[model samples]
Target chain A: MDRSCVSSRRAFLAALAVAPLSFLVQPDKAWAADGQPITKPIPSTGEPLPVVGMGTWISFNVGGDPVARDARTDVLRAFFAAGGGMIDSSPMYGTAEAVVGSCLARLDRPEGLFSATKVWTSSTAEGLEQIATSERLWGLQRLDLLQVHNLLNWQGHLQTLSAMKADGTVRTIGVTTSHGRRHAELAQILETQPIDFVQLTYNIADRDVEARLLPLAAERGIAVIANRPFQGGSLIDRVKRHPLPGWAREIDCTDWSQVLLKFIVSHPAVTCAIPATSRVDHMEQNMAAARGDMPDAALRRRMAADVAAL
Target chain B: MDLLSYSLVDLIPFSRETYFRLFERYNIGVWPAPIIGLAMGLTALFTARRADGWVLRAPFLLTAACWIWVGWVFQIHWYAPLSWPGIYFGMGFVLQGVLMAVVLGWGPILGSPEATDRNHGPGLWILLFALALQPLLGLLSGRPWYGLEVFGSAPDPTALATLGLLLMIRHPLRWLLSIIPLAWCLISGATLWVLSVPTWPVMPLAVVLYLGVIVWPWVSGRSQLE
Candidate 1:
């Protein structure tokens, strides 16, 4: 056997030995050895990113409200405590980037943070300015990833992002589109653009990307970040109205949100799922989704069918 | 750029909780403004009911100041941080204030006997509703009393009260003055509707009622020949 394979097997055995005690101590440690988070390699550079990341959309746009700011700090604390890595935001999300910066400042800027933001301006020159603004607002010397938000002026912004990536101003460059908008164009960009990641709206209910964009990302060695994993809380809301299926235990899902999250990240092509939430409890549930048994292809099909039936 | 691709929820970036907290912090940060605004609204109401001739312009002047205050202070300084479109909303409000000041406050046409006719029907009731009742609606949503959206202070009730005051006046240019207030009513209604607030329909419903009341006098042939 290969040496790396032997090492992996030894790690697996060590995890098996600690599994029962870890489960008794903290359920999140049962799957991964030493309670480390489950991570997926970014295909471009093979950096391990936690499969579940938090998105600061409406959740972090509190806008100078001190009470709400502290409350959001608690949410971030809960997220980092549960082994979260990437935190994605955009200028278009109003004060979300600023609020995230404030909360991270309050938290002393966690080392595990994978600071991801976007350049949303239509002007190519303005894209550089926006990236600077994002870095300043994030209170970071350099951002880990910068995406072209919603593919707005994707061509210009992507060129700028490519240059930024080349000069080491930003580590990773990506493009994003949500609400399943402009997938054909997104696919073309993924085919041609030398990008690191592509974010798109993907949930159990909305699988339009499954037909083409997802596979293309895999083939092109692009990391896929699934936005709206719960379809902006509506999918989980609708699904929660129905009782959890008995078979949900097969993947160790305790709630509809975990099940929904598990379904998204379980896909082989998907690199991560960014779910935005305001509550600490919800953050814990989302992070928990990254730790447990992920659904297989057969279970994924059943999960989708069951959710669709609901 | 693809405007059609967006939904109502996409336009409202903040949650309903944050929005309510906005008013709470605004009300606290600009303390006594809400009280003074309510006082100005009451003064306008009294002037509209009891005074006539040049005194009639008091309500228009007061309403104009309220619009300007809300545009600059509340919308620009407070709400704009939460949503960028608030800057446009503030500019619209400032323009509305200037228009009200120019057309209804100082214009000779507004003080005319025909223009001063008191609309004692639904118009007065609507004005009263905007003054005393609209602020209470926030309580229904379980918001703290400090977060109550008040007239001359908050945009929704300010716009509604402007529409109510416009309904009372009979000037030909009243429709011209009604344009921004009406537009604000619809815009705010859509915003609140997207926020899923229970009182979402109140502003739009006020618009409907204002238009219906304006047309009813003409529809019933109640207008006298000029």
Candidate 2:
């Protein structure tokens, strides 16, 4: 090989080596107006986690496309840049977990990244393999949180997750379900099983969880991660069609996305709300929810009713 | 996990953009496909009224070509990598195509006297819709007109037009022929539903309409099956 090409290659490797170290030394610049993110604690461990996180379902499933990967890199960068953490992915989301890993690996500072992915298959052996595969994909030696996706074989996976947690391989273990599904069973597992987190669908429009799951999680001291925070986009899309209600400024929400997101995260039981977005602008807007004082109970109800009216 | 109520779009191996990009790429790479699809659609339309034994086979031949094209190009080539289920969908499309060819070309099902056109009413309109309306929908939905998922170059149009042709044929194997396409309508519809695309309800409505057409003859005491 030519000397110039060899030197360039060495420079690239050197930059890669220095990137993580640079990020580690630098203080997190993702501060909000108060110079700190509004955070909620992990109910079980008392570990403080930023309430706004990123979800990679359809958003990060871009496969082997360089342009798409570059775009997602910006999205991840924005997520971290805005004091985001607890990125949740699953093997079921096609290439999402791998894409997230790739993005984080290339990033300057993914230190705040609280890696969470799921074990999605049927058999315990397959679930174990999937969990290991997720760790490898994300390049994490110890996963912060791992869950049974959609509660598929939760009985088996829960035992496996607990075992992994005991071994210190996984820092936290939990179960996830969305779209108002399997709540009864999920509740049963949460009550019967000793898990750290329970992820479910909770948005302004979909408050079915508020009655049972959220209360149950709070009562049980299990952390709650809210998915489908905007009713999978329709809610935000609807809210965006109209001007933001003047009352939105009362809680310091600049846009409708923040208003909707803030409503979910403000719930006493919600540990975090992971809204999936493919664009950097959306990530910026989403993470902005972490800033600003959240709506109080009456304001939250008003926000819900106002959005519902739309 | 709200598994039961979840959007089918998640089951799709690729993103909505990637799925549509298949059309964008196919339209650009294979310019001849749309032209061929037009010609084939015209041929089916012209042959729709024919009762002659050999001439009646044209629509079935067109349907088979459409099924095969959509199977290979849309499903196998573009969609398979996105998810494992995509491979099954591709295989299903291919099998449906082969089945159509076998039935029309050979014995047991749509053979000899069975391959006859009766009411071309719904079929003609449906074929025309497949050829014309589908692309219009695609264009209205923000996909460029040039990148329209034309019949034979696309799965939705191919499946829609196939249902139209099968409706006219009045064969015992008609429903059998309709199975995969009907299923595709539901699957694609659900995919659209989850993606929050405006056209999500269109496929399910089409399926219901086609089912109504298929069952009309029996319900009216025309008794083709009897």
Candidate 3:
């Protein structure tokens, strides 16, 4: 074309050459090694929460109230320190909601404390009432997500929730189903609703969500939240007895918890997996799972097969 | 209420004669409680001058309550009754109410950030309280807890009633309610000289525990801890 156009193209290539060298000296601020939130955007409202989060199920399973609450505080502190925002709790977990609330209040609020709790009541009004109570317990301005605990009072809760969504009292809404009991139903709901996110039991041992749910969520543009990444102590039970495979290091996955977590999160539809842990060390490993070089579908299947064979 | 001690034919499902007799004994007029509650809620909304969009919540609340009772009795267990298809499709419905109220309207329903009482709070709680009568009377009527026993072998009505009472109490009033019936039922059920019955009937602590959970906050203040 013209001489100036030729010179412009050369200058652009020179700039690209310098950009790679600048990257060698400086890394992008968007992410840490965990591949967690460089930044997260709420699918419903375009709000972003950090991809790293904490799960409060069996992890905070301390028998005594004090121990459980303190343990949760440490776990939560670790999550926030590591740039985590979402904290998933449920009425099913007994004192988990209370303890999580206690911890959040005790800490005087962390910057990234995006609270998500479930309502496991039987009736619609009761469910709504619990949601109100949970908000008060946590002392947050608003919750990031409110799921139905194990799908108790599912339809009634949803109808009521639709009005709330229209009113804008809550920011985002999602559903959570643990175990493989209602995958088909969960899929159907995802198919129907304009759901922002879904939380399901998924791990290397239980990658069944990958075959259908994950794919459907991807297609429907719904974000996925994975729970039971340790299969609520199954992965640790299985792999704990076995050694970490040699290939674990290829993806920065060093522990069984990290390995299992990494596999679930490797799915593109997966927004994040809330792995519960009472121990700060376990929380560290869990947060690490959000990091670099996640396995692709092929590798995830291989990981599944390996866990199966084990 | 008199209980039937089982004989050798115990393992089989209840006979038709017994089913008819048991059905009459339980006399489940409570089934319509939720329906009536819905009608009243709708009526209340109609009568009120300022109650605007809040009126629409009645159907959803009534339906969820009905299903909760239905689901509880369907599988016959105290924990979340896992009916085959009901458990499947019900997840969305449950989460929807939770997300909606918490995300959207928890404040107005709870009577705002202040202690000022709201008009609809009592109506909503009373409508929900009507739902508790079914399980309460179910235990009180002393029907042979059959497919109803959903929990175990023999029926223990006292525990169920006590559970109902505890649940009916507001969050702060929890200490005021008595579990004498719950304790007596369990102790009697455990100690009573049944020749050889296996597991006891459904006590339903969790089910009632859940009821207490949802209802308590609504009755007293907007929360449980206080």
Best by lDDT: 1
Provide the DockQ value for model 1: 0.66
- Model 2: per-residue Cα lDDT over B12-122, one tens digit each: 645668656656766767678878877887787787678776667776777687788878877777666556567778889989989998887455534446556377777
lDDT score, candidate 1, position A225: 95
DockQ of each: 0.66, 0.29, 0.02
Tell me the TM-score of chain B in each candidate.
0.93, 0.87, 0.25
Report the candidate with higher DockQ, 1 versus 2: 1
Better of 2 and 3 by DockQ: 2
What level of docking quality does candidate 3 show?
Answer: incorrect
Superior candidate under TM-score, 1 versus 2 = 1
Candidate 3's DockQ: 0.02
Q: lDDT of all the models against the reference? A: 0.84, 0.78, 0.53
Candidate whose DockQ is highest: 1
Best by TM-score: 1
Of the candidates numbered 1 and 3, which has the greater TM-score value? 1
Question: Which of 2 and 3 is the better model by TM-score?
Answer: 2
Error of 3 at A251 (Å): 0.7
Between which residue pairs do clashes occur in model 1? none
Ranking by lDDT: 1, 2, 3
Location of the lowest summed lDDT over 10 successive residues in candidate 1 chain B: B217-226
TM-score of chain B of 1: 0.93
